[model samples]
Target: MRPGIHPASRPVVFRDRAAGTLFLIPSTATASKTIEWEDGNTYPLIDVEISSASHPFSTGTARVVDAAGRIERFERRYGRRPAPSRG
Candidate 1:
């Protein structure tokens, strides 16, 4: 790894506002805000809208799309394509 040419990697706090969770991880991202962690240390705070804690897949609350319904709608609007001829 080259030194001085890369962005500085330091401890940053990612706050999942939806889940009220804070994760301390190394990042190159910078933030104007700061937060005091449980360990009595201050770190740059980055607020995120979504994370694994609040994601639909992680929470098992994802909605399954109806592929059949979409196909039916497309056929109704554009009609079905004819089968390809064998060469």
Candidate 2:
């Protein structure tokens, strides 16, 4: 182990602003608030909603796509620009 090359394991916090969720983990608690975890340790409490902790990819929650947007229709009307192509 070098003098200052080894990675340190510190407490961190992850928060979702939208969903208003907060979690404390061992890494970098740079979100918001504070919390004392069960490992007899304390970290900053971050408010987050869709972190890997509660996201669909990790927790199997379904993703809701906004279909109300008429993407195709909007694009068909005015969503293109003349490409400046190279000769």
Whose TM-score is greatest here? Answer: 1
lDDT of 2 by residue, 17-70 (tens): 655665565773354556676786677675655776566767766776766566
TM-score of 2: 0.38
lDDT: worst 10-residue window of model 2: 23-32
Clashes of 1: 0
Error of 2 at 27 (Å): 0.6
Candidate 1's residue-wise lDDT over 12-83, tens digit each? 999999999899999999999999999999999999999998999999999999999999999999999999
By lDDT, the best candidate is: 1
Model 2 residue 87 lDDT score: 100
Error of 2 at 33 (Å): 7.8
| Over 4 Å off, model 1 | 69-87
